[model samples]
Target: MTYQNPKNLASIKEISARLDDPNLVILDCTSTVIPADSGSGFAVADGRGAFEAGHIPGAQFVDLERDLSTPSDHLLFTLPSAEQFGNALNRLGIGAESRVILYSTGQPGWAARVWLMLRAFGFENAAVLNGGWKAWTNAGLPVETGAAKARPAASKPFSWTYRPGFFVASDEVVARTEDEALVNALGADSFRGEAPIAYGRPGRIPGSVNVPTSSLVDPDTGLYLSQQQIEKIFADAGVKPDAPLIAYCGAGVAASNVVFARTLSGAGTRSVVYDGSLLDWSSDPDRPLVTG
Candidate 1:
């Protein structure tokens, strides 16, 4: 049976049934967080160790920091150039016809991060695995150990089409007009400058409303809430239904989760992720941040 492309989120059952489809490409996009030696904030580490230990059968691993992000002296996961991203996809054997499934070990944010990256690069056939690795294991799905077998190169190099507006920089965020809604995806504590961990500075972009990524998912299942529930969360948070949205978190990773949930709730066309997010925003003393 042929694999059917999911709109944006796929379930474990959907993937388990398509294990034999040649056109299917499953990616483990896990990245773990470690406490920085300074002991103030956190640092990110590649999940190669976790992936090497075990992962979904036939799933290759994609290191968000090393494989997908552009190397930057100051930034963490800045989006790479179109050509660079295209080359990476080609190396993964992702072709125009491939249906990609992305999942992470912990939060779905890691998977959503890659999903947004794929969409920004104009690849529309990718989907995030709902509930991710945890849900899969809970269901007793088959898993494999050790490194992934090298993927066969795509028949032709991936043709990249850059889609503007899916990812925006700090300048666009700074230039946001009154009509635009700036949404913070960080937890309420961080947003309110009460968290022990601060990204440069606690607090959020001035005038941004909170729609914490945590609120978008079921605490027990690790799966996203129903579409109606998500939409209500947005509305309750004062997110305008029709206004353009700029989503951000400490860095850009969690913001992708918010963007993904918003999209799933039928309000994604007007949403964009601030790629640099608060990491860039808070670095500049000149940029204003508001605390409650």
Candidate 2:
């Protein structure tokens, strides 16, 4: 098998030139954090509102909670059925040969989540837009207002043929964490129990090391860290090259960032994202959470 680096990320300039490519499909996955009434954790910002206001030309808006996730009474953005996800993409005109480019206006992690979702489902042509919306607007690229028309969903039911080894579970967290490095992709504050921000509980899973995905991107540029820089960040977090690593975060979104970064760093083959993350762990009071 051939190796591909930066497998989940792409730059605006690169995608800009290929906007007219028939095989290309671009999606906007912008989402922000909001406050909850109970003050338990957090809520997601309205991606539809943001997309309606402005977006890359010809880019259809994809909702993390709606288009990409399943309807659940308890969870917020759990992964949708493979058929559900495929139909959503099918409606966007994505096909067997389509090269998907995903972006976001807020955190790059949001875009990464979609990229990871597509990747886990055996789709290899998907990638997150580097620097996302901020970089696009800052670069003076054309931004359009209002919604773009989407292609109709396929008449045939989208079948789900899952590709394993892309995700990890809570029980697996306990079973394999000793042998594999568990990286918590949340912020350092949460790592220290100072700001558990979003979750039913306050703290983190036992044996998980903190490697906040935010550290791997430039705040001003919104671009990912360089290879050298990514190496240092992982090193500081006790992550090693060629090691088996599982990334997790609040509700499993930010973990995508780490997963993508690992791919860029040549360790992706042994990396996986814990899909349920803190949302699943924090639910069971029995799950151990340690604070600094």
Candidate 3:
């Protein structure tokens, strides 16, 4: 039986059952993410090579860097416009009536980023394949080797209507200081400045609390912790369920997982990822950063 879990998660079994749905659009968001400490000067590694090598049946490759981000002079993690994103979706055979499922080979953050992006653009009928590629293979699911393929018929029309307010900037974070709680989606070391190697600077936004993406997921399985476990993790950090939150990390990638977790943690909390993150925050001489 085909089924979708809360927070837009699709079990491998659910997707396997609906492998023949006409309007089902599956995207392989598999990416090699090099962290800030990699010294490569780029946070994201090219994932096309992996996608082109082998992918799930009826899956298309979604290039996060080239397709989702626009060229900018400054080194910031920014998103593309509605038109640009729409065109990318169309090229992948996605349309208004499609149900998109995204999955990745690495951490859930990569898949979550794509899901969060789709929601920001007003398409909420998308899910991340829980447990990702590993889970599928572990479960002995069949796989196809070769180039990417789109599930929807080529003749299907594609479109996207933009919806705003899925992300926050440094200015807005400052403006909403008193209202929204800020969560640092980084390891405890990075959150506490001990892992300065992971970021440009050694501190965090003054009031942000630590909620490492690693904690919300199981490293061995790539599956998320139960909703109760996730909520307790946040609640233990003093994050209020009813209040809004902002998630940030070294380059804003891990923050996506936190936002996705909040999406799954039930409706009382709404979280937005700050794309620029601490890299943008610490770059400004005037912004304050704190460390223990």
The TM-score leader among the candidates is 1
Number of colliding residue pairs in model 3: 0
Give a tens-digit lDDT track for model 1, residues 204-286.
Answer: 88989999988988888888888778888999998877878999998799999998988887774489999878878888999
| lDDT, residue 77, model 3 | 48
lDDT of 2 at 263: 85
Each model's number of backbone clashes? 0, 0, 0
Q: Tell me, what's the RMSD of every candidate?
A: 2.8, 2.7, 2.7
Predicted structure 1: lDDT: 0.86
What candidate 2 gets wrong by more than 4 Å, as runs, is 1-4, 152-160
Candidate 2: tens digits of C-alpha lDDT, residues 1-292: 1224866668888888987787777898877888677766887765888788888888988888878888765566777788888777878887776788998876788888888888778788788888999999999999889887675443442344567787878877888845588999989988877783757777888888899988988989888878888888988888877679989888778898898877876763488888778888888888889888
Alpha-carbon deviation at 8 in model 3, angstroms: 1.0
The per-model lDDT (C-alpha) reads 0.86, 0.80, 0.80
Worst 10 residues of 3 by lDDT: 33-42
Across 1-292, the per-residue lDDT of candidate 3 in tens digits comes to 1222384888898999998897888888866756465542445676888877777888888887778877665444478898999888888888777889999886788899999999888888899898999898888998887877544444655556666678888888888756688899989888888773545578789888899988987788988888878878989988887879989997667899898887886734468889878777877888888887
